[model samples]
Target: MSGLQPITRSSQLSVEVVWLSAADGVLRYRSEAHPLDGGVHPDDAAWHVSGLTLCTPGALLHSTSWRYARGSVVLTYVALPDPDPHDTVAVPTDAVTSGGGPLHPSPAVIPIEAVAAHACRHLALLAVTDPQVAAVAAAESPLWTLITKLPCAPAGTLHPAQTTATAPHTAC
Candidate 1:
């Protein structure tokens, strides 16, 4: 076991960011938010979703999504471009701290596809190792089924998306 522990729990979800000592990297998991009796927006129904973010020192690596439906979870990782200037939210630096000096450099601009692929590989590991995650994968939720097809990699093997190579990779 990786000794996963919760670092924070907000009203919406619980988050964990842990160092995988054996893999020499980090793994983050955010639990799905509980579904409201009806939905957040009646006009547009909302389903419960969880997220994961993976990063190494000096970079914001990848982001992933897990959507809950039909008593199962659907997983997807996609590279999302930086938020528009108008949509940016300011974070108070004083409220943030990390054992690792600084995990991301200012103005980090990683490609979305790379982030997605990297997230896929990590999700694959969780699918096999974590019972909950495995159940989700086994359910084969339909979200992103037409796209984001990701093959499982050997445990502990870093995918190309984690490398600095410039070649484009498919999203997961």
Candidate 2:
């Protein structure tokens, strides 16, 4: 076969998707990426996900999960959004230093589909690079999976807790 086409890394994209239960939903959502600013949401899927990780604050209340699938990975975490009503901040990509010092592991959340695709692309490299990772392919193998799979409220939707009416995206 001819060389597989490269994955898009552009700042823009678009696609339609089906949003089922936030718990066990698989989707085909298309994303539109725009060069991200400080506080606004990402228009692109990759940026959107990475932005999720960045917005998710590291905390004592925060937890971790992992799923070492035979050929895929999905990551998730509890995030703390920006504090002030208009507070736009930035965190380092490699490592972020908090008032206390460098924070602990900040896991990245990639959808199962993305994970599967990555595995297909890097199978050979992965086989030789990390065989042990290949042995376990369950959705609950990695710490990030636990963090992501935990049944949390959906974005822009409300569940059983609060008394006040917050915005849709504030569903926590």
Candidate 3:
């Protein structure tokens, strides 16, 4: 999907995956990663991230972005349900942080609530909100943070125009 962005608060993610072209096909692996902006921090101060690496299995790539708005964070993924009668891959804590690796050995699907909660937690982590804001954010269903301000280019993913708008620094 070109220019496809998921804005859902509770959408299930099958983990960010990396693929290696093997004799059979593309072997996929998953990992645990925080959003570049720590989208789940939920505090009241401005949050900033200089760089973030989304990793899986045999490769590493930097996101096209560096700085993200409090509202810009959204959970995005491709979820694949398990295929079996009664096999299940236990959700791993490491899976959330480093992302899951290898195909799960059972058959199961992620619930929408799980997706929403994770998205909420992610936003909370990358966020800086006071008690009041935090409470509201926490209570917000399909939780998502919305930010409004003059457009500030993300650190790494700044649009070319944004870069051109800045005056070159001349030190005396």
Candidate 4:
């Protein structure tokens, strides 16, 4: 124990701001990275980052998942903008990969694209099941459209087209 080096790791907050182009129907997004401030809770950090970076803070901001990569435990969040902005970093939905399922016997390597897709899929489920989330989704046209396009899956599998019967409760 004396000679062995201590393991070092950091926590990160990864925010995915997803929105639809009002005119072209293109789904655009921006992925932001921030340090987890020791003074702030991860949830509060995610919301603060979302509000600061987005043109308009989304009505629906929620933590979607967490992953270990690059020597850090990344806390991923999904934020949906209420009013679509003119300029947004664009990534096609097809770019999102279905590379791994959560329940696979062996560890599966997942890419950032799949993570973003999962975030959207999580929100889509919330919109339907949570009354508060449903209201927010309904108020924002672009957000609602982007959400509807996301795919869902049953308890075991991960697919964009299907949905789970129950979803975790959301704060929004």
> Number of the top candidate by TM-score?
4
Which scores higher on lDDT, 2 or 4? 4
Ranking by TM-score: 4, 1, 3, 2
Provide TM-scores for the models.
Answer: 0.27, 0.18, 0.19, 0.64
Candidate 4, superposed: residue stretches over 4 Å from native: 1-23, 52-58, 82-87, 94-109, 152-172
Point to the candidate with the largest lDDT: 4
Full-model lDDT for every candidate: 0.31, 0.27, 0.26, 0.58
Ranking by lDDT: 4, 1, 2, 3
lDDT of 4 by residue, 104-155 (tens): 3222345766666666667677878878778777776865786666664422
Which residue ranges in model 3 land beyond 4 Å of their true spot?
1-107, 129-172
Could you tell me the TM-score of candidate 2?
A: 0.18
Misplaced by over 4 Å in model 1 are 1-108, 142-151, 154-172
Clash count, candidate 3: 28
Backbone clashes in candidate 4 total: 3
lDDT of 1 by residue, 1-172 (tens): 1222323332232211111111112222222223343234411212112122233121121235342233323333322111111222221111211122123321123232333334545555556666655644564433222112434554235468854555555565
Question: Which segments of candidate 2 are over 4 A away from where they belong?
Answer: 1-27, 35-50, 54-172
lDDT of 1: 0.31
